[model samples]
Target chain A: MHNFEFVKPGTVADAVAALKGDEAQALGGGQTLLPTMKQRLAAPETLVALSGVDEMKGICKDDEGRLCIGGGTTHAAVAADGSYPALSAMASHIGDPAVRNRGTIGGSLANNDPAACYPSAVLASGATVTTNTREIAADDYFQGMFSTALEEGEIITEVKFPIPEKANYQKFVQPASRFALVGVFVAKFADGVRVAITGASEEGVFRWTEAEEALSANFSPAALDSLSVSGEGMISDLHGTGAYRAHLIKVMTGRAVSAAA
Target chain B: MELSDSRTIDAPREMVWQALLDKDVLKNAVPGCQEMSGSPEEGFEAVVVQKVGPVKATFKGAVTLEDMNEPESLTISGSGKGGAAGFAKGGAKVRLEDDNGQTVLHYDVEAKVGGKLAQLGSRIIDGFAKKMADQFFTNFQEALEGPAEQEPDAEVADGAETGEKKKGWFRRMVSS
Candidate 1:
């Protein structure tokens, strides 16, 4: 809506350098940033596009048993790659085909919307956010609703997630946009289980420790039956009540567990 | 959407209630609050940025305290607009009760959103509302719990990590 300058950088270093000013924003897929700008919610004087940054795109596995995903990888590539089922499924479900084809992981995490799928994935998988200056733990990376620990001008180079032993993501999508109304990502690691929920509760993206504890003892669907997701602090709106969403957490947790199993 | 949850704090009700009233403490605890300042008397003003799915909006508004019962119970309400992203308004009735030496907080919050947030993004609104509420209470818990943070041991948990939870890893790999 407002007049803004755009700069497509040739590399991650170039993009970071160009993002020095206060009103400068880094554009990845333009899935989130462009919409915000068009809505006039954000009026950055300059957009440092990372599309040309070669180092900021792709997928690879490290010898350390970790997978590193570049920030600029489109959702389409992810969803089409069956090797990464969870990421592909998540990307496939984001908005629609157009959005999936264009949305990038770096842009999504940098934006850090509480209900965004990537935040859930990162948090659930216990990933690391690798940026220009620092590598933030997944827990520290997400600060709060639409907020993150990233300093201004910091560009997320890649995110590292340990390949889970077995994992699955279950989301109850809103019909129109295919975004999670309430989604759950469940992983059973060696020490314990990790359960992450999105689109259901107000705490933003969070690990359901209680449910994880239940699953750690027993990784079956019935393990979550006795776990009561309290509605006391859950969000209530036109689509559903706090209790309703809380109910979905358990139900979806079961489905994700079963799917992963 | 409606979000309600309670957590038991190991402190007295009065102390917990007082903590709720402390603006500086609240500013730090409330999620996505870029800036929050004001008094319980004049009602506090805050700027909150929220993102759900593809929608992102920043809301600026004021919150007022009502139905105060000192260190026992109170009601807090606020309304804000996020321009084209949408507008939202809500209030919470919070109560603190003594549970032995601990205090248990009970809250009931009601909120409404208009514009694109209400129209195009209604499905996840409940989830978003619930998540925001959880962040509010959780932040309160953290503030009460103190910040002697624990370093999450990723190396220890790496082997156990597996499954479709690998999306972030794939994305990272793809980008690299």
Candidate 2:
């Protein structure tokens, strides 16, 4: 790994200013960024650690019942917080105990790995990504696999996830890493249902419209019985086939609905 | 392991086939492809950086056209190495059929990975491979659809979903 400067900022302003260089990247939990850097897949000249920024930590309910989560909150903290069950559940399953203790909400959303659990949760919850510059909807936040709408040096301050009337997440984890091989997060709002999928697609996390349509009608596992996930746009690897993943999507969707119900 | 999948695009077969060759379309569709372009010898070349869990690797590779039936069918083969991360090689056979006015592109792909990636990763290779194929085709479909404002009226299989709900109080949690 290349030698790089590490700066722990006491405020968001300092952190933002510290990210001026082209080779500078914000370090949240260091869950994803550090590993990438160590592997030399990414070699940033500097890492602006956000742990010292007290403003970017914690979770609270907003005036509208939406949960406002500081980007720097750890997975262990989120998982232990009973108020945000969905988000907490996601935090608990990120990688392992050590990873959870160090990973942050902002890091996960910014990195946006296709199989990562946080993306699915955020998308399903219809969250808004609040950055120092602007707020981005979850739909627009994820650009593609391992990509996000975040511009260079732009830091994510917080995320706003609408607490659904009923919601649950179910993932068939890759045993070793505990990453979702095919993870599904389903949430039902007063108006309809939102189904987000990670690990199954090539383009990171995406909404499962067919399952949503079915669940929107009844919000039950049986509602999705007739729906068959499209194998056309999925990942086929040594672990499973495209067709098999499509099958798992349905089975998982059903399980999610059952759990939520 | 061998893995394959495809999608029916809402356009003419000719248009869909042309979109397959378009650099911008491919750049938008291929996962982790930072740069993509057509090479000499009826092939495509790209630079990609892949990150799965704690592993990350960069690859520069080319996809050669093995067989071409124009708007009807084509076969593509390629391979890449990501230094310590690993290496991968694969081929895909694509067939285009006209369903009414729309083009249905059916593809079957077989891929293999070796080195640290194959040895350390779990049984989720199929899942990852399927996702990559889907990204390619979906990007292909979006590109062929152009900047059209209206969503295409098409029939497709069910959509995929991922779930990561809250765990019980006693469950172990991984951060970030």
Candidate 3:
């Protein structure tokens, strides 16, 4: 909206350098940031584009048996990749082709919109978020809604997810925006199960620890028969009430667990 | 919507009430207040800059103290316009109770927004309002507990200026 300098850096180092400038913000896929700018909600002096940084744009596996995805990788790319089936499936359902094509995992995580898809996957998988400087666990990285442990000018270079034996994500689609009105990602590992939820909290993406505990004990939908999600601290808007989201969390988690199991 | 919270400050209830009348205390307690000046009775002119996620706005408005019941309870209300961004108005009812040497401060806040901001999701608006209200009260509590500010002799000054016109909330700035 306002006249601003745009720098498309070729590498993460260069992008980091570019962001060190006064009032400069990193540009990911421009899915969230661009619209925010157009809305005049945000006006950064400069935007350091990460799209040109080829170093941060792919998916692969490390020797640790972890699925490592470049933060700059587009949702479309993640959807296309089959290395992590649950993540891929989750990515495929994000918005339409236009958004998936342009939205980056780094942008989504960094923005940490409460309704975003990627957070649930990363959190559920117990993924490691690697920035230019250091690696942070997903639990520590996501502080709250639209908040993160990211420092100013910090660049997320890679995300390492320990591939689960079986996993699935179930999201109740908010028809208008296609964002998860309430989404649950259920991942079952050798040790236990992790259930992370998005689009349902006032506090942003959070793991359902009670459900995690129950589901871990018995990897079945019936294991959750006695448990119910509390409506407290849930996101209540025109799209859905907190009570509605609380109910959907149970339903979605059940669906994910059934599918994953 | 509505939000309520309470905090206990080491300051006396009377001192806490006097601090409420201080624009300096208010400016510091407000999350992003850049400027705050003027009398509580006539209202204070304030400029506050806030950033919620990606949205940033500079809001300029007036804060008024209404329905004051001495050192017991009072309402602080403010409305701000942020150009094309929109406008936000909110009020908080603060009640102070004496607890030996300390004071327990309880506040209930309500907020409303319009224009471009109202279009933003209610979840965000509600969350931000809660955070702001919490921050304001927490800041006030901490400030009250911290090193003391000078005792405001505003009442004597008010009596000097008001003469015999009125004895209530009509506080006139006196040239000491």
- Candidate 3 per-residue lDDT, tens place, B1-176, comes to 79887888876787788878888778867778888989998899999887777778889999999999999999999999987689999999999999997888888999998888898656688877887787677556645554225432221223453244232221221111
For each candidate, what's the DockQ? Answer: 0.20, 0.17, 0.46
Q: Estimate, for each residue in A49-70, the C-alpha lDDT of model 1 and write its tens digit.
A: 8989989888888787777888
Q: Give the worst 10-residue stretch by lDDT in candidate 3 chain A.
A: A32-41
TM-score of each predicted structure versus truth: 0.69, 0.70, 0.90
Q: Could you give the interface RMSD of candidate 1 in angstroms?
A: 4.7
Per-residue lDDT tens digits of candidate 1, residues B1-176?
A: 66576878766676677777777556655666777889988889999776553354779988788999998889988789887767888878898989997889999988788887777556456656666676677656555554224632121122343232232232232235
Off by more than 4 A, model 1: B1-176
Point out the worst 10-residue segment of candidate 1 chain B by lDDT: B153-162
In candidate 2, position A20 carries an lDDT of 92
**Residues B16-102, model 2: lDDT tens digits:** 776565565556556677777785256788887665533557788886776778878888666888776678777778899999878
Residue pairs in candidate 3 whose N, alpha carbon or C atoms collide under 3 angstroms: none
Q: How close is candidate 1 to the true structure, as a TM-score?
A: 0.69
**Comparing 2 and 3 by lDDT, which wins?**
3
Better candidate number, 2 or 3, judged by DockQ: 3
The 10-residue segment of model 2 chain B with minimum total lDDT is B161-170
lDDT of 2 by residue, A1-261 (tens): 668899998999999999997668788888777765665656667888999999999989889888988999988888988676766777787788988899988988888877899999999999999999999999988866766778778999999989888888999986656788899999989989999998888777999998898899888788987888778657766667668888999999889888883
